[model samples]
Target: MAQRFGGKYSPSGQKPEKGTPSAGPMNTARVTPVGLRANLMFVPAGVLLLSSVFSGAGAMALGLIGAGVWTGGAVMLREGLKAEAAYNDRKVARRPALPRKILAAVLAAVGAALAALSAGSEPLLTPLYALAVGGLHLAAFGMDPLKNKGTEGLDAFQSSRVARIVDEAEAHLASMADAVKRARDRQVEARVEQFQATVRTMARTVEEDPRDLTAARKYLTVYLLGARDATVKFADIYARSQDAQARADYLALLDDLQSNFATKTETLLIEDRSDLGIEIDVLRERLEREGVHLDRNL
Candidate 1:
């Protein structure tokens, strides 16, 4: 049969590849050949010829043998495209494709060889002919396991082993994520401790020297600013927080601070630092603000 299976058509309305939804009649959009099964006909064809040589192969074998060449060619072309796609896909990802492409290439070569044998004129060729075809098919199929791209033959034992490895890796990642969260929590605690220290320092300054309201007031400002920073951090961590009591406590504290920060400290002659964006140190103003009074016990 004179059959032209694949040919390029630059003419208008010609489908670019097979398997395309827009391809016109005859599934012309399907790529010429691209897939694992592309040249798979060699497998059955070689089996047919080899079996026929020994035990008078049945009609099934004959049918498979007749279509072997074209089938293999078609499959190889398609799968070869698949291999190409795999290769192109790795350009940006840097993913290695030696395993899969090698497997696919091995299969393609077997199919090509089987198709090549068809050119010969013989109902059943010499022993080597069928043996070559059969041997190659066996080798090509063997590529699946040898390449280790797919675990088709892995027994239950091997499957369990792989599963264990995956589980262990996931556990390790989870542990690391937990450790990061703990460290972050610790940092927040440190900030809270520092702010509390500033408040205590403010109180002590007033006790040490009743007239040193300037130093005491500066310390209070520091405490307020520190508290504002802590509030922001708490908001970040507690976004979707479900703890009712904790949420209430934080909200109450925020409201109290916001109220205090909005008003000016009469004796200090300055707005509370928390209500403002940043602290500005004014030596003259600090010394002049005598109206501010800090009681150590308060």
Candidate 2:
């Protein structure tokens, strides 16, 4: 499959053959192996690979070995077939090298090699078997923890539409700042500058990882906290301005707060959390302390 540009997939740039139909793979980070390939190949292959136990004398040991070989072989064939099918389907120019297939092929080939090597020294096959089996078990167990370390759910959502969101967000910030500056009021201009700086920080953080979105989230927390502070400071200075301009500055403070909240909403689209409540409470308390009452919902 074609790789994502940002945090999402796009199979958009393609022309299927006249008689061909395209069934794209799940275009997300958490893609499950699906269709027949997953059921027959991935499931069985895993079971068989884990069945490699060599502790018994004859019958049990032989059975376990047979089970392992059967499952491993089947998985390799099935997954390999899946790859071949993908190639045939024109969905992928090359098949992905799943770890299970490589492991199975290695184990099978190594078994043959060890058998030949231990021909005269039959007793030596015991250590060889234990080593191969134990090594694969360790390898399999290690894969999950390592792969799960990246930003959660971000891979599916980042490249979702890079150019569009990036442009939209930046343009919105610029447009709003222009609106403030064009009003030709010093207090409004000052608040707008503070707001734009926070936005720039958020944008920089989001763009840092087109592949990983957690960084963007971190930036948002910083941005919101800073925004909350700015609102309080603006409210304090509001009493000093003339009546109409003071209300304008308060309205401008609301505008800045709105921008912060909107940015947070966009960030939350790719990440989910409950940390926003604390920031809201902080903003509310500061607003009340400054005697600048305003509805803080949305």
Candidate 3:
């Protein structure tokens, strides 16, 4: 009798052909207001450079200096925006140590002042142009984060430990991605990305409850490092041979790792919920003992 094809043993989704990897649409679109502004800055920078060609030595030097300072400001603004995005994504985060936006504004104002002075503008006009440019820049980009988020009353030592572990884990993930790129196989890339998603799930769970760090330390450190090394070795081997059996084995290993990571994250969440329930029960008992009747209906 022939075995039926629709059960646990069967492939669940549309499977790709052997040795052919599935590819998804790339997410190339991004919201980059700072980046757009930075690009637009090149227009003014080019104008300054052109102006320098027709001016005296003093003016030429000042024009070049102005262009350099303005360019630096644009670069700083872009980095500040990126840092802001990362800060916003986390439940707990530290504000950027340096105020990049403010510094950029200062640099832009100084650049404008230098240019005005070089062009033989009246002293009064030079200061006015500088102040106007600086004020406009401040208005356009606003300010950097001034306060830490969700860090009140938390244990500082524990938070720092969690941050260190997460940073190391992120490095491992980045290394894996870099190694996999050398293999030039879409399927391998997809396999790595799927595993990364599982890793991120676990990371988020830990972030929600830093107490879970004790339970998840090995998974975050040792296992991730091992995976990174394996990815590097696989990329080297596959680049030269493209061995089908090796590729299959690597992919199967990724599947197992992803499953385990996902399961561990779910377990941590369940435990957290159970702890919350116990706390609620204890609070209710205390309230009842104090003769405080709870109202079930509003």
Candidate 4:
């Protein structure tokens, strides 16, 4: 995880020539909910399945059912966490429609109850086991967001439009990232990351002020669609032939696209500041007309 640091005067810090090999391996890290806690849920499921082979017909049936439910609950919980992370990352997002985490908790509870019953636990204790398992699962993973975030006081129609456009833009970026992985070139991947960061900055700006969506829609959609297509095509060629010219051309395209996107985002910000200043001026003039003199600093 040690990051490379370089500067203008550093001997080893110079940018490598386009056709040269990069120093590090391709970083393919991704976010997922498969940590220790999530993995542990599979243990009980595995135990049930393993024990079932040694049991009678009815007990084996019960054990298999319990194991299946437990495995399903674990998988659902992983998906729920992934969905929640995506929801939190967005400034404008609706609550998940399915509430996967809650359903996962219910499944965990039922699985626990069935497992306990299959093992001949006391009748009264089976429901307690269910409650404990469900409660623990809820405590660990938490429930899905029950309501939309960052949508208050906005025009719903405009917000929805922005959301749809942002979603499409995100899809393009994801496609670009996926395509670049095929090239297996670290430098190209890093270049793609920089371009993606620039694109996301524009996306965030439009999300913050949906009015800019009108001006930025083409960059978000048409240009991004072209970029994605170009990336896919470039990846196909470079991955097959390791074409130096193709790599250089693709990197140049990214450089051009990143610069344009950054400039557009900056312009949007300046315009937003201008609009704020105009509103303040209008309000100040109205106050002066009402015989309310204000200090220059005020």
Candidate 5:
């Protein structure tokens, strides 16, 4: 088997130079990959389309309709799964606006009924087929999340503000990724991925304590947006010329970005610890004022 070419000199290789600041790790947990199981949902639709060729006119029409519905439901199911994975990856998240999995289930049921009807099944038995299909779909994929995560005891206004800022930051990160693909340099792509990982660390830090959002907002917004714009410009230039100077400058910029983002994340964590300490002190004072005595260690 042929192996991929990755080395210190390869355009896509990631070998850190001496005195370079490491960006921790390049691989980070991301939204679950769309797998073979998810693609299997399309199998029924394919079968319906194939069988339609041998059916009578009315039956063929029903088969075609059933196939379309099945395909649509499968698409919906894949998207719902992706959305759910993103929701799960975050420390704080709101439930999806629409329950796509549930809607997909309904579509599966309807498609099954059409398929059964086209097969000349009795009216009474067609409903049973629909029920079975819907139930099986629900079992395989499950329902959309029913509640928010990490929102308890949080001020609604503050939480919403943090959510909005994080959303904007995520958009910036996405733009950076899209912009860099134009460079078509694997090494540069890996470097950008590392920088993104560092940025997400800060994002998660703010999510853990919305109070940190105030201090970290600039890093998440202005800095991130600037990085994204730089990426777009660099990719455009490098794609045409493959300039070594441009690549070196861009890599240097990434090094600076990773260091700064990592430092900011550490600062946010320290601030969160200080806030916790203050809260604990205030609680202790309140308890003492109420004539409650506690051990010195407690």
Candidate 6:
């Protein structure tokens, strides 16, 4: 049965069976500084909970509140870092309007103050301790972006439209990612990641030229939505049956989508260059008509 459609003789061959985990670094979870900082909250949370055990009701309540607030702040800081990474990846981007890192630092400091008060610290020293903690937090993680980036001379309406489309495309990618997790196939996960990278390339191209959004709207929205639905369906089927053929076909689809997206992005970049050339030629003609003689090098 595996030989049908030249499956047994396919140039690429059959999919590898699930076996012991690979030792390759690619299989390992990425450990970022932000993730480590977020995880550190657990230690303080545990300490606060343990200290609460030996204290009165008021102290216990305050300690618990502090622990919860600290955890929330850590989560917020992690999200802010992730957002910052995404913003940095693009050639053009806007700063996050809310300063999440700053807010998180403030929350952590307030939590520290509450814990100090619970421990019966001197009232006058509590604020100082809180201020010190907050300062350290801000110094360590830094603040979120304070200004808009790469948005000079762009129309507000068009920029907003691009943002809306990109947001929707990102949601589709997220859905595809979540669905693929259910499949539990490393190859499939890698394939999805490849497709996502290509998709993001197209997205960045559109962002660099909002006019391209009209051309790319279907690819970003309709095609991505379809891919997400297909991934969800494929994950369900493969999870139950471990169907090799289905996996191969899905991977092939991803390859096609990736190729198309990459091609489209290249085309858009070429168009941008063409437009620049036309602008240069127009300026040169205008200078010539004005009887302004200039050196060829100039």
Worst 10 residues of 3 by lDDT: 21-30
Q: How many times do residue backbones clash in model 3?
A: 0
Candidates, ranked, TM-score:
6, 5, 4, 3, 2, 1
Task: Give all candidates' CA lDDT scores.
Answer: 0.40, 0.46, 0.82, 0.88, 0.87, 0.83
Better of 3 and 5 by TM-score: 5
Best by lDDT: 4
Query: Residue-wise lDDT of candidate 1 within 1-298, one digit each (tens)?
Result: 8954553454444453321122234321124324345445545556545544553335434434544543544454455455444334221111233444344444434443443444433545534555565465445443322232233443545434433332343243233233324334433333333333333333332322333344344334454544544555455555445444544455455445433533323332332333232433343346459665444353
- What is candidate 5's lDDT per residue for 184-206, written digit by digit as tens? 98778877877888998888888
**lDDT tens digits by residue: candidate 4, 1-298:** 9988885457787766653434555443345655788778889999999998798888888899999999999999888888898788678787888999999999999999989888888989999999999999999989989999887887888988998898899899999999999999977888887788788889888887889999999999999999999999999999999998999898888888888999999999999999999998888899999999788696
Overlapping backbone residue pairs in candidate 5 total 1
For model 6, where is the 10-residue window of minimal lDDT?
19-28
After superposing candidate 2 on the true structure, give the runs of residues whose Cα lies further than 4 Å from its correct spot.
1-157, 211-298
Candidate 1 Cα deviation (angstroms), residue 19: 29
lDDT score, residue 91, model 3? 84
* Model 6: residues with Cα > 4 Å off, grouped in runs: 1-33, 294-298
> Residue 156 of model 5: what lDDT?
85
Summarize candidate 6's per-residue lDDT along 1-298 as a digit string, tens digits: 5654533357866644332223355532323536676678567867887898789999999999998888888888888887777677667678887778888899889989989988999999999999999999899888888776677888878987997899899899989989999999977887787688789889988988898988899999999999999999999999999998888788877877877888888988999999998988889889999998667686
Q: In candidate 3, which residue ranges exceed 4 Å CA deviation?
A: 1-14, 17-34, 293-298
